[model samples]
Target chain A: MPPATVPDATHWRDVQLHVVTGKGGTGKSTVAAALALALASTGRSVLLCEVEGRQGIARMFDVDPLPYEERQIAKGLPATPGATAPDGSPRGPAGTVHALHIDAESALLDYLAMYYRLGRAGRALDKFGVIEFATTIAPGVRDVLLTGKVFEAAKPGRRGKGARQYDAVVLDAPPTGRITQFLNVSDELAGLAKVGPIKSQADLMMTLFRSSRTAVHFVTVLEEMPVQETADGIADLRRTGLPVGGVVVNLTRPDELDAEDLAQVIAGTADPAALAGDLAAAGLEGSPDDLGALAEHLLAQGRDHAERRALEDSQRALVAGYDVPTYELPRLAGGVDLGGLYELAAHLRRQGMA
Target chain B: MTVSSTDPGSAAARSATHRRSSHRVGPLAGTEGPAPYLDLDALLDDRGTGIVVCCGSGGVGKTTTAAALAMRAAERGRKVVVLTIDPARRLAQSMGIEELDNTPRPVTGLDTSAGGSLDAMMLDMKSTFDEVVESQASPEKARAILENPFYVALSSSFAGTQEYMAMEKLGQIHRQAEADGTYDLIVVDTPPSRSALDFLDAPERLSSFLDGRFIKLLLAPAKGPARVMSMGFGLITNALTKVLGAQVLTDLQTFVAAFDTVFGGFQQRAQQTYSLLQDSRTAFVVVAAPERDALREAAYFVERLADDRMPLAGLVVNRAHPHPPVELSAEEALAAAQRLERRRDDAGLHDPELTEGLLRLHADHVRITEREAALRARFAATHPEVPTAVVPALASDVHDLDGLRRVGELLAPG
Candidate 1:
């Protein structure tokens, strides 16, 4: 077979936004932060936005909560103090990155205030429990608001004609189970609202979400349920004609042994007496029972290794079933820090996703 | 929180011992013949038992279990209400409700012909928060808090806010049920998020968020010297104000000021609720599937309940796959595969490939059985006293009341 063509990280540079979502605990925020850093490394100004006020990306970047305003959390290139650009822009570095956590309810209120010209009506209605009812009592409204905030951040200048503020935006969205509902909220509201302003806004948001300029990455662990959910989510997204970018399998175990070698080891490691002699030769002292225990331990270790490989294989098969590019991130031994996220981002870049 | 007098481990052990003794009574018990189901009547006889908490990891049918348990209580002539926190609308559909919010709604189709009634409610987190503020604060204060931009933002957008509000809703329901002398039982179906423990911690977290020292310090009026000391802070806050285009900080300040008075009462009530969960009437049914990860989470939950002295009623493993018995040796199975491969040319003697595949499948099933047995053994070692019931995997999704009844039948002892 001929060598396959692999898309490089530069392919992602032209894409205006990336939305990362998966099952809860699947490291969606980490992947979003990493993708932002990776894109920033290529000299693009990136805005990493998180809906739901999770503040998870802040922890990933080792910073406090990124306020609603775009604040520069890191500079991809080295910065020189008081540096100025030829275009009269205050330029300290080539590649700059900003982060923000969207306060969804506030964003929704703002949207309502701006679009409906509610003025004091918004505040009054909010006090009358309408805001709470809209956000919490309704099933999909909050998700719609959250997605609307993210969609706004993605195309910041689209609402009002202005210069595009950020080159790209990375959104850490809700988990996979609710993501389709969140993204399709515009469609949901269109049926409910008909020819209203909200319906038109939902229409525009839906267009942006389904456009080629947007990409949705599903993050998952190399476990059965999450992988199954990922597969289901991908199918659901494809059914809705949404852009399913790729799968990022988080916290995968390292490949220490190949199948053939593992089989050989398992087949050859059955003799307790021989194992005892080998251990004795290796400078370990033990009696027959202790040596027997050691042999059983080795067998158990082999079984665990086999099981992990089987799990990885099943996960890969599930991802392959969706025919999406799959990226495997190794499990970090310790805490997930900013540096580790950047490394993962670099890997994504190398895999053709900035 | 009130701790139960009966030791959970001893209770589990007694149940297991009873099962074993019952098995010795006749072959009927041992052979899975129809027998009298486990009596729930004597198990939950306490009139003071106000709440039943069903907690476990996600995708373990915790909501269904809570609903069914509440239904069982209601069917036994006890007024019961089930509070579910599933974001999905399935709970409302399950309870035959067209809509559900933070407030309790009487569950229809409860077979009132039998003189038993059940009520079901789904927690709407934001509405619950609104109710909390509205009920606790004066009308003007409530309006201020509810209308404040920051309050609206935090109540709706915060990650653990739903869990916090769910607890608040539970407290409200529990109090109302007590006041009305209507509900004899309140079953709470916790959110299935991995951090389901938030249900226990939400009250404290919410109270602290309402009256935390850091928030107080931030909200304090900037004096001449204090302003000088907080120069960088003033710059940041100013930038924040400009970007937000509203007095976000002031809004938060006003809301917190209004919330301050009720903060202690909220914490005390939460503590009391937590204690209520520990009471004997509040049976903790730890639900899980046969999957390793779900089992692991269940084990952790069981351990947490045990350490906290909470009343653990029993264990319910949902969707456990049943494996076929092993009748052939590996060598014999291999021989059969070979024979089947040779007989592929023969006319339809259950195609050799099919036979071989079945044999291989049977072997795999045996392995799965061993793995499940190992898991059960480990659980028994840790929680030997707790009686465990396994519900076999259903052929289809439980979509309606009939499906729920089927599931209930499977869960009930026979």
Candidate 2:
């Protein structure tokens, strides 16, 4: 499959799922929440899920612990005009958007109970600390359960089962480094557990994950390490034949200086005499040391400007190499909050990510 | 390289060299007066230096730095174990291991043509917690703690549990290494969290959580009304009972009751471990990338270490982009690009597009260099006394032992 394009609210409507992963501090949950709100605004019943129980999404939406059940965190805000009801029906002002924090352990227990006809065994295992061992001690099992829970949530169910599930499932997955493993653990475990129900389930999970319906969006800062990790994560996921989606380069500094301007600032070879004249005009007074310090200060400012530009350029270059459509999210001057998430969603919408 | 302590002139010169050198050491230079890079060789020279703790924020290559340093020590025929908490599979892949959990696993491919051995383990957080409870608690107590639903939830769900367990794990590893007399050095990679400073506070946090004042109060017997009136214990106990459902309180009391016997030993050992980290032989390498934020985090970490009197070993800035010196002026490049753009318009000149792209690329490179320089300046200002080093951005992903070796080479003594 071709690399998944970064979805705006519109694209999100077409695609039924979105997965966000990044480094721990890189704001994956925030993006997932925003994407959900954005998609919901476009008249889709969006389900936002956080598998790690970070409660970050709930915090972002100003809600308490989002229970295991999906709750409508926001209706279509004015920003997203087209959200709809559950039945492929038109949404009025009372559109629906839901959020859930997947308790991975609970989900794993539930999955085992439902699928393996091992509910009693699962309960016993949990009592004997086997559940804890499987969830936390085992490397890939948690990832498998988490991914399975998310995948299961994405599909639409029969009418009587529930409000026809979610139109789209947005997963705030594990960090980028472990995301490929998290998403592909079922296959890994399947290899380890051949000729079993788990193996069959893993096969199905892999098939679902590899399908076109699934889209993985990697959130990253425009810095060296996170970007590198994002790239590596993308490459690794691709090797597993998973859909490699777009890169969201978060917290990019604004393009404040152009090349020529940046160069002039850095060279210190710029006509200091002219800059001194400008400073004098601007009513700054100084002795020769003061003037020299002033000039040095100006040069440093110029250098800082150049550095920011370079960082952005490097980030763009790195993202460009992936050949997946990359979206740049500008660094907000203030800390990110609910309003900021909404603003980001709106920006993405404008860029055709629905 | 050795300057005599009595040679005043040489010492002064050496200090000056260190100052100058610190400025040159990536971002950590210049901001702080330069000290030489922490001499691990010297630290371990005594054979008494048992543990080296590498602490810093995330994405700093703390794991790689820890591995490299441990490898360096191990290569010198010192049996070494590098304990890392990085959740990445690459940690095992880097050490050429298929898997590593809470248990210390032998690292393959460390038999450097020099006949030394390296061992590595990824900190399995939950397993470590289980081990702590298993070791410290009586069999019945362990069963109670393990079986309790709240205990299971709190052990995994509580914030800072990982940090507390990490300390416990560190102590375990250190004890094992010390007893074995096989490993000369044990290196630790800390989890990246704001509370990563937890190592400093872990003893108190663990002790308090286990059997501190709150738990002690819970465990106290219900007093008669007259006795309660005398101390006001009843009033406080009533408040706690109300806040935590009676059952919840009972569960906690049961857990703490089981844990009470071991609490003193745990606290004392924790204090000892805390002191152990502060020892001269245990150096703290603050690993960070040269990014503005990471460096800022590093600055805060370094200052915190300094404030706490923790031995600041050195700084390792990893994945630093190497900017090639600018060759062409922006004006000239722009002009060339414009000319190329015209040619492309006229004749679909691929060469012109190439030139234009090259110019833009150069311009981008210049910007990156400036940012890197500023980072270096900021780091220098704040941490001028610390010796620092930069690990250049590697072209390939560090997935295997060879990649780690390359990283080790960069970290090795020049």
Candidate 3:
């Protein structure tokens, strides 16, 4: 139950689609990007998709605003040859990576064209604001369209013969609060359509979602609220029979005090006169009262750290109770530049996540 | 303590001292230049200030800040109601209530020395929407609308429903307060949308969806002027019928017809609430942490508030890491700790790890403080006019009233 323990990553080679979601401000997008990079570096070509239109990918890469089109965003270091799955899917080799910002409106336009083959009628609908209706006013339709794009990208031979296949597709999905509704969108549409092509597509999507090939990972911090949310989110995913993946505990701060120091803080057993003597020896000149203040300050901070570590222990236990692999990323104190993103990817790789 | 406006000095110097003094009063000293002091005490204590909206991206302690503000305002003798959209159950329980619902409930164990009281409610969006419809539409129409499949979906799980309901609930409380003075201050915690503007745009979006031409055309087949239902509409309806089928269309029209009667009331009420948001008495407190994305969102909120001419009280940078009170550089701390480590390893010094750990901890503290100061400086440089108040990171997550009181003290240290 110790925090920042990067457990063995049960390797997601068999999974095709990875949806990363968590509480807001839990670094969901960053975790998704790192997972994508890790998957790609291990020799599996990958696609990174963002559906909420946050432009988070572009910002993380420090690139110009990406248009609503699929394009190459990054390249991974070549992977050495690796094991193959039982299905004869070659496991890991050096791969290429691409990104797509899934625009709901554009997806709707494409969806209508694909299904109805309505060239002029599509334009008429767009003019008459039916496109807007489908994109906006229609409650569950936009989510379906956004999700449909991911399905096409993940499906083999989706772009016709000789089309590039993605070993993994990473979706930086909505936060945990809305994730169940977002992924269960097919069920939502089923309630509406009853028996149409919409229902059939939804059924297909739900099947894909619940299968072993799909996994939704929860990213969270060790704080009480996010940990509580992660536990709740995992339960919801399990309740609906969605494939739940491992937990990515993001932004864990490094330990600043060892066990003895923590014990002293917790037990209130530090000798004041001895601390004053040590301070004088260390060239920190202070009267006995001044030394007392310094010792008190450090002890207070130590006690605070002790409390946080204890709380984090309970949170880690809660996550462990779910019986899934858990990986941790330390709080990057160097301002989270592109280098930090790679550092996180390397951590995931070391943990065998990819 | 209030950053003296009477200081006759160079503008920059006055502002610098102002910034420094505010930081020293609370937790740490910031080297960042003078952004105006937010004066949270003044903002909360003023009788004219009625509404304080806390908004940011998710997980930035917006709820904690709102709850603390409510407590502070109440203790300051202004009756307060804090409406949080979906707080964790434990948090509600910590406030001495099993759960918060649509109705405001009195919170016990307050100081109440100033004859002030605190009321808290969690915004139940679906129930609020139902209440809006029940109050605005006739009973039969309301019942019909509530039961409609489309209406049920929209009211419960739609994208814009929560935001619209937040506005609706705010308007409801404001109206009630203005009439009978149930509370003088209404503190709101907004939805955790990716963009803060969602709270501002949701009502407009719902209005557009209802009043849009497609809806008019859908309803036209059943009830419309012959001229309005031209040959063009007939062609569009023919295509729509093939696409959506007749039953779905009928459901939508029936939902819209019953919904349309109260749709006007919603739009007008939303407009009124939007105006209230823009009023001088309303203050937008954009909350963020010392992080890149959160501050980026905060900047967007600042620009949006300005664009809409909303009165921005200031920015509240929560969870700020404060530097230690004593002056010690990271280099000095690290050097001292290394010497102690050498002594411990070579000469068997007493409690070596503890002493060394203390120094190292101090070093880490200094480094984080420097980094956060730099980040704050960057934010200050971008939007210098926006006043700011900083709250240092607490040791534990805030739960009960005592935790909130500590937060309130830091929010505006007397």
Candidate 4:
């Protein structure tokens, strides 16, 4: 069955901006890329922005290092009559995916130029070191500049010839430990800038965030720590009144045991005699001792599997309790590659996370 | 800033224990010569090694490894202290404490009869920063800087502050060891970041930010003369006003001024800490999971540490899948499983499905075990000079002293 959250379809699709975050190491960048791909796969153009200077998006797309300018990495296909995708997401003709690696220093300069029309002074501002100090070192404004870039991209496109509208803007934001404080721009700038064009910009950003136009999606694994962070991160977003979107649990292992076997193993009551007999019938034909050893090994493995499922269930319950929509991406036995990334995007599309 | 005598030129450490595994060859044969495996127990037990810093990206179990190492060191009789920069409460709970503050707390239930003791503390990055500020600055100035909105924001959750403060805290603990012999060894769990090098670079970044010409330029509006500077400052400030507004600029200037007096001290302290880390007595243990991305990150850590001249102890590959004991090949097992399933009704088998399930699980285990082995071999091939240890994935989440003890034993198993 489709996840309860995605049934409305438009619940996530209608929003123009989707900010993706999670605990560190949850593949947040990969998920953001996949979401952008999935959104654009339906013929809807999307922009993927990464703020951390890691150049992760470049590596993800297997392209040369991405500069500050927006570059088209992938184009989506519109849905075909019966097109089968490698990752299993339904596919057709779609729009393109353009990415921007937002450097805080230049982005701050961009913001300044946008408002004050500073050209030579902009380059001079960078030289004089105010840009680096404020954009890189200054607290609050650094994040504002990063998220501000996303907000600027996600705005309703300008009205004129060559006006390009984005179906969604996906931000590979800071990890959970700092995301809330990073995204809470109004509160941050409100305290610092009581009244100015900067404060007005902050106000505009917060207005967009609190509105339905923005949704923050968290990427996580079923592991306890990342799961806890996922729950906590969502609560932080909610506290700031930023829209909390679906939870994308990454690198999930498929359950090997069904409910019946799991219950038996959890209770530690699986029949050893039966297991040995079955092994013998299958041509092992070993002594009882060897058979018993085999049975014990199988039981231990089954027990571990059962215990993990139980823990995963509790972790899933934690996310489920948050009342946010969630999507699970299966663990790729072979590590993620360009093809695997598309597979994941197809998976996300099938699940309607786009 | 005092430069250590050792800083001139140190080549990449060829200290890796496992030499070329000539027996195996593939795409992963890393370009290298042989090196020694890391002796974690010996490193912990050695009096010469004063500190063990576990550095890695998140979800790699660095905190657990640090705790286990500290526990082993204490049990081995080296009054040890572990400082965890991780925000997770697992360390406190595992040590049987409700909360771990900036100050080290003695852990109970350790086998101290051998004369070793373990003390654990969670690094409250902000509190640690405040403590440093409070100790460094006069009372009035400390208060003003602490309450400043800019300072509050920067100190609390600022990006680089935690790593900088961790370095400071390490220096503090090391100094404590020097003074009254509070603890001889410190095992630090570095903060989780997009890049582990941040731990090595944050203090320098912070120091540079404080001492950089940009701050002087910002102060030019108030500190420098107006005749030559006013025109340029005026244009910049005019532009800054439109972006940051005049009020925000004033708040920033106020924070920098209040924080100015300590710039020299901050720079000196950061340098001192860097020198201390580079000292031979300090050991850097890079931890990673047995995955491609994690291994790539581990390589980055290893290279950066070498460039910085931090004494490299070795690499710890955590949560690796152990090769299964059964001799049955996955194909044979599957074939047997299919037979059992086909004969479920014909044969008097008690639970044919269970046996088939067992066979399938075994196949998966074998496959996963081979994958993990390949990944490890790949890493070994690439950085054969980095001594390495592989730890099997534990049966459960490590949440208590006993669990940590188990990890400690596995880390350097007999």
Stretches > 4 Å off in candidate 3? A1-11, A77-93, A160-163, A270-299, B1-32, B96-100, B225-246, B331-344
The C-alpha TM-scores of every prediction are 0.56, 0.59, 0.91, 0.89
Better of 2 and 3 by lDDT: 3
Q: Which portions of model 1 show Cα errors greater than 4 Å?
A: A1-174, A177-214, A217-354, B1-49, B87-91, B108-115, B222-246, B325-339, B351-354
- CAPRI-style class, candidate 4: acceptable
Q: Which of candidates 2 and 4 reaches a greater TM-score? A: 4
After TM-score superposition, the amount by which residue A36's alpha carbon in candidate 3 deviates from its true location, in angstroms, is 1.0
Candidate 4 Cα misplacement greater than 4 A, ranges: A1-8, A76-92, A158-163, A266-296, B1-36, B94-100, B221-230, B327-350
- Evaluated on chain B only, what are the TM-scores of all the candidate structures, in order? 0.79, 0.82, 0.88, 0.89
Question: What lDDT tens digits, residue by residue, belong to model 3 across residues B159-222?
Answer: 8789889988999999999999999999999988877779898878988998998888777766
Clashing pairs in 1: A8-A352, A9-A352, A22-A176, B1-B275, B2-B275, B12-B385, B12-B386, B13-B385
Model 2 TM-score (2 dp): 0.59
Query: Model 3 residue A102 lDDT?
Result: 94
Residues A286-317 of candidate 3 have per-residue lDDT tens digits of 67888778877877777777877777767778
User: What is candidate 1's TM-score for chain B alone?
Assistant: 0.79
Task: Give the lDDT ranking, best first.
Answer: 3, 4, 2, 1
Q: Which parts of model 2 are misplaced by more than 4 Å?
A: A5-8, A11-21, A25-347, B1-49, B94-101, B111-115, B211-213, B222-246, B327-335, B345-350
